[model samples]
Target: MDEAARLGLVERYIAAYNRFDVDGMLALLAPGIRFENHAGGQLTAQADGIDGFRQLAEHAAALFREREQRVIARRSEAGRVVVEIAYRGVLAADIADGPKAGSVLEMTGRSEFAFADGKIGLIVDRS
Candidate 1:
């Protein structure tokens, strides 16, 4: 697929994520999708297939009362579209020793996406 089309898929995924619509996000993923999340240089999450990804997305959605991610910049490389992201979310639940519920969490990150059969087959998110 072309870069624009790939970027469109990513945007739709982010929109679905912002709305906490797990189904909507899953609809754009390939059946064999692979997803990974890295925070502070540590591997924080991973899901190997669509089913696994759905579970991960659902769980994540439940943790945020409200969230948004905007694509601030983008570049295409080696069949992947990498985009700089700005993220902001209000926590819905507190962690044992982490930020409390209702606290606003903000961060800058980047997502790399690879498409297959017009759907996202791989996604790596780092922040």
Candidate 2:
């Protein structure tokens, strides 16, 4: 896809994620997409292929009642799109790893997207 199209796709993906629309998010990915999630400067989770991505999304949605990602900055370059993100969510369950239930969680993060065959092939996220 062209740069504008690619960036538009990324925007759609982020919107889907915020809406907790797993299928919508998967529609923008390549069949064999790979995703890595990093937090606290360490690799925290990974999902391969569409099905694996579905599982990951569902798991995350279960923890947050309402999650939103605001794109602070985004740019597409060198076959990848990098986005600086501000995330906010309402905790739906006690986070054994981070916060308590009923708490409002906020964080700053970045996601780098790589494309292949005009679809997202890999996504690496850091926070």
Candidate 3:
């Protein structure tokens, strides 16, 4: 994808995440997309298709009560887009399971997204 298209996809993806629009976010991902959440202790999610993505999204919803993505910076080099995102949210009560109950946490992270065929292929997040 061109730089504009790549950046647009990234922006849209972030917007959907901020809105907690799982379906919308999934729409922007490739069938076999893979995302790595470094801050989440290096958790990796692979969406082989929309169904897989939906499942992941559902899990995400269960884990986070609220999620906000603040763009710190963005740049495109070659065919990859790197985004600096500040994340803040509360962990979902059910997902936290214990110590995190009623706890709100804030974190900052940088993610590098590589787009292919107008869909996200790889997302490496370093928080």
Q: Pick the candidate with the highest TM-score.
A: 1
Per-candidate alpha-carbon RMSD to the true structure? 0.8, 1.1, 2.3
Q: 95-116, model 3: which lDDT tens digit per residue?
A: 4345474567687889899876
TM-score of 3: 0.84
**Candidate 2: regions farther than 4 A off:** none
lDDT: worst 10-residue window of model 2: 94-103
Question: Arrange candidates by TM-score, highest first: which order?
Answer: 1, 2, 3
Deviation from truth (RMSD, Å), model 3: 2.3
For model 3, the local distance difference test gives 0.80
Task: Count clashing pairs, candidate 3.
Answer: 0
Instruction: Show where candidate 1 strays beyond 4 Å.
Output: none
Q: lDDT of model 1 at residue 94?
A: 96
Q: Which 10-residue window in model 1 sums to the lowest lDDT?
A: 2-11
lDDT of 1: 0.93
